[model samples]
Target: MNTLNLADGYKVDHRNQYPEGTELVYSNWTPRKSRIPGVDKVTFFGLQYFIKKYLQEDFDRNFFNKPKQEVVAEYRRRINAYLGPDAITFEHVEALHDLGYLPVEIKALPEGTRVPLRTAMFTIKNTLPQFFWVTNFLETILSCVIWMPCTSATISLEYRKILNQYAIETGGDMEFVPFQGHDFSFRGMAGLEAAMMSGAGHLLNFTGTDTIPAIDFLEEYYNADATKEMIGASVPATEHSVMCMGTELDEIETFKRLINETYPTGIVSIVSDTWDFWKVITEYVPQLKEQILVRDGKVVIRPDSGDPIKIICGDPEAEVGTPEYKGAVECLYETFGGTISETGYKLLDQHIGLIYGDSITLERCQQICENLKQKGFASTNVVFGIGSFTYQYVTRDTFGFAMKATYGEVNGQGREIFKDPKTDDGTKKSARGLLGIYKDANGNLEMKDRADYETEAGGELKTVYKDGQLLVEMSLAEIRDLQAQEVAMDLTQEESI
Candidate 1:
């Protein structure tokens, strides 16, 4: 009885054409043979396809952009150039055709699955036994597509958690937590594959980005939309500028220049600090303030150094510092008296706005509201101008990830697979199996694999090339969305294994 199994059922057809089993294609990897098949002896066609579609796409963009015929020719030339002209003789091609396993596709793990330690998120197997060794060269692409998205997505999710807490304390009322994280770690990623993964990180959970290149990758390889709303550009906001009358000619001129440049259009605001803030407000503000109004007659002056939460807690915008602030306070008391003027009252109400910028932590955010109650600062008057401590550096390198080879079938036996005992740190685990992504009850994920050279499950990644006529073309976003959704589901409990 013939025991050879191929993607297009070899029975009754190619049995007369080719030899079976070991005489077929295999990777040229030969270690002291363990329980399952070890990598050994690859064929030409598989190597050619891998170089055309994946290796070149990542290593050289020119490799990716060139026409398919050019790519195949280049690949063949390189193979012959390196391995010798006699290496890929016609007999090799004929032998591969006889095997009846020419193409296959890996369904793969989705992009943001919160993958735990040690799992093969991808599976690769034969499309035609004759081409099995020819196709094995695609292992590199599997790694590129799978882990890059996995690691980046995990980091982005963590960033959101920290920002979420900070936003709540700072008086942000939102229906849901929004992502404003970047794949900042992209700078440290391994290579082109990692760069693409960095972009995927944003898709799983993030809002804006400074990495513009990643945006393009998402559109090309994964399929995601580039929208202003996704990047925090849709929020309409207003701003203003003001100065203390007595700092210097330049400071006053600078403020006046800015004021003249911006009033009667958008929101108008001024900072009355520099020197004797109270005196400037009691003197210069009452008249020019009206001239500076917008359609809603609202203006915003920024608060810094002093406790910002108090500004929104319902208090006046006074000079807040050391002995210097006291001088301004006293000058105002002498110049305008202690009966807080209608100007201060109006500034604290709807017509005016107070904006603050400083070491605004979640703790400080709470204080801003608390002090507002103590100082009588209007909550609506205060608009936070948060910087440094809150916007950047949310998540560190915490998520641990690793890829493990799980299943395969070879010879007459079928079983799960794993790497050789550790001699190399983390870099030595190579795949050897038929793999698949699984979701158990409670939405957890698991990778199922048959050992190298073992019987595989029915579903395999399909290569869509029939008669060498490229039959399928998938856009990046379509794949990205698919990846994004896959990651949204649960994987195995990290602690469970």
Candidate 2:
């Protein structure tokens, strides 16, 4: 027979937990793609597919319901044809199953920030350019690795800033500059890959996440945990006390009882004003202040309903020159009637903090900020937990993202070509030829034309795979850390308004 039956009785629980320090290494890599048969070459290709397959694990085929072996074989052939023949084999196949699709060398910005179009977040320099055809297959996976996380992260950063400004405009004094919290996006994520990406988004600016796998991935893949060393890091965590999604007198009592049981030491939060906000604030807040805020220490109060402008809304009747809400009032004490103190001081009123999760966004944040300006509450001590619209459903992220074949150089002549699509669906058009990179005075990236692929300045575009060998080696922690740094440094901010 085919001797393939020997692979039987192998209960490959591809889903089982791997041992802690187990590393899947492609040890014999050579940085050159072999000129092999049945291979294709193209610039900036397969980027979207790579992200979905490796990071997302999206393998749903209606084309056929064939055996798992057949599907896996095709994948192996494709990977080997492009990466290297020696890159993988039967002996190490099980390990490959363990690592998922590993994130290779990626150039990306941190999760929360702005990025410009037509620039490299990071580049994939194939270790094996000669194996041109095989190495080109990675274009999909490499591009997908970047696109969405960077996009969602950039947007979320602005959302929080706007909310903080709004709270200040409405007369709420900001206390903590960057508040500590967790990402509750588990219910909002599209899938495990999305969940993981969201977790990366959480780490960009916020403290931490509640997802255990996310935690494990962060540690195993990134090697950095906020709970321990980093003084400012937020190692996300939570407790399962019940909650009331409404505002009422009984609701306040219910919230109080839960607080009493869960955080007897005094640090916690309750979703106040489930029905009637001002009334609950007037009736319950003062009474529970001692036990909830003083007994152990201090707890944060969350107001999920009502316009943040009104709840922290200042009295317009107060003169601009008066304290607290006065436009000309310069000092915190002049405005709040008391100097800054820990329990009740200028800072408490001037430096107090909170989280606004109700329909918050960048534009909404800007509006809130304007409202606060009129109210005299200009403090940068709050955060916004963005949800649903942006973070939850991000599938178009095909990165639809593509790199063009800007210029192709034949034996001695070079030609510049652009795909003239019969019907342009966005991704249909692309630049023709070999790609090269250059750095400008500001250290930013610039792509230039190449008249000859046989001798281009940026070396060959292909890397990592060479002559049936893998040229470079990477660790998950290393890739994760690099991605983290790349995202953080992704600021293309303009100084003027």
Candidate 3:
């Protein structure tokens, strides 16, 4: 595909629409507001991936490395067909191709930093005077590529915080927290690329994921080595089809074969709601209890279709002593009993566990943990499969993300520009002039708008990409460590409150 075509249709004619003497355009990407409750910050991520994949590799492969005439003619052909033959000329395209590099500088907060609302997470400007339009010309693709990872990472951090609080409260193993929130979002994502990006974002806070390609993406772009370190991992697991193939009447046989013949060892997750979730939990599981307990590892039961909170923590309205009333955790406790935590919460036997993945949200997650604590069970007894319901049901506006040019220069004169629409709420009002981000005395990141050149050049933002080359690189390990530190700090603050 022609990399130039990977933009909004209206952006094609933008090169000629700028003022006659426009020499430089300085723009910043900021999250103006957050619509998510209790989430006042956004996670800064995917900037490095954008620079490496789109800015450097894509341009070099499809435009700069190709023959100038071929790419130029292709660009002209597409524009002519879309907007008539004389809609725009191809001079700028040919000139950029001849220049052999994208002339833009991108300075960004460190990947994995939790940037506060209204702060500029990154700033972009043209390096050369003639390529000022390139600053915002790249906006369409940059916004498309960057938003999902940031959104997913932010949402993932929320999940992490919830799990961490419950784990500490319930005396659960803190190391198990990373494996508690597994990414089951790949199959339900928009496409392969979206899955990889969102899945990689989820991996920032968790080590358990079913998104295999996400590991490949991190390795290729973020300097991750699967052999040397754990990127993302999943245990042997089964779906509805596997159980159905073994025949419903002989579901017990399927369990026997799996626990006795197939795996007989490490952790294995089997989807239990294929036929009768209650029967599997109350009857089939008890019939196989001896086998399950005798095995060398844990047997994780997955309930895929139900109200996740009620299903895992018991349906309160049901009969008092029934399987549906007791839920998966209590039902398992009846068969394979385990010890209690230091905090007095019931710890499920090491040989059995439960995971619920259907349509999970942060609210539901918190509710489940709250209910479990009330029922004397540790919150760690159930692992959560964070599927598309949490990762895909979001947009760029989830954090009110936008990229607007605040400062520009024309004919050697600097201009500080902004917009405050009277009809709309103040959320759309953008910052004026150059922007810089700094930490105040409270140690919270804050943005300073209308700053002079020197102030804009300093503070938390670092130059990650410049003139078509990557200036700073962060490995997956480094990003994960940084995110862990932020999460720890957040947990500390929450406790005080």
TM-score against truth, every candidate? 0.47, 0.58, 0.99
lDDT values, one for every candidate: 0.39, 0.40, 0.92
User: Candidate 3, TM-score vs. the true structure?
Assistant: 0.99
Q: Point out where model 2 deviates above 4 Å.
A: 1-115, 122-145, 157-182, 208-212, 225-241, 244-250, 258-261, 306-353, 393-400, 403-417, 420-429, 451-497
Clashes per candidate, residues 3 or more apart or on different chains: 57, 66, 0
Q: Is candidate 2 or candidate 3 better by TM-score?
A: 3
- Residue-wise lDDT of candidate 1 within 432-489, one digit each (tens)? 5554445567555554544233223332223333323334444344443443443232
lDDT of 1 at 112: 32
Identify the leading candidate in terms of lDDT: 3
**Model 2 compared with the native: what TM-score?**
0.58
lDDT of 2 by residue, 1-497 (tens): 11111121221222122233322211110111112121111012112223333433332231123344664576566556755785545433333333333333222222221223343332332232121121223444343444445444444444434443343334344334334234556567777766666555454444434444555545543445546633123321122234443324366666566557655653455554355544445456555555553345444445566555444434356554332232212222232232333322122332213455565545555654565444344433334445544466454332334533343223324446456677865444543344344456865444443335443335322343222233443333343344334333432232222
Between prediction 2 and prediction 3, the one with superior lDDT is 3
User: Which whole-number lDDT from 0 to 100 does residue 469 have in model 2?
Assistant: 32
Task: Report the lDDT of model 2 for residue 189.
Answer: 73
lDDT of 3 by residue, 347-422 (tens): 9999999998899999999999999999999999999999999999999999999999999999999999999999
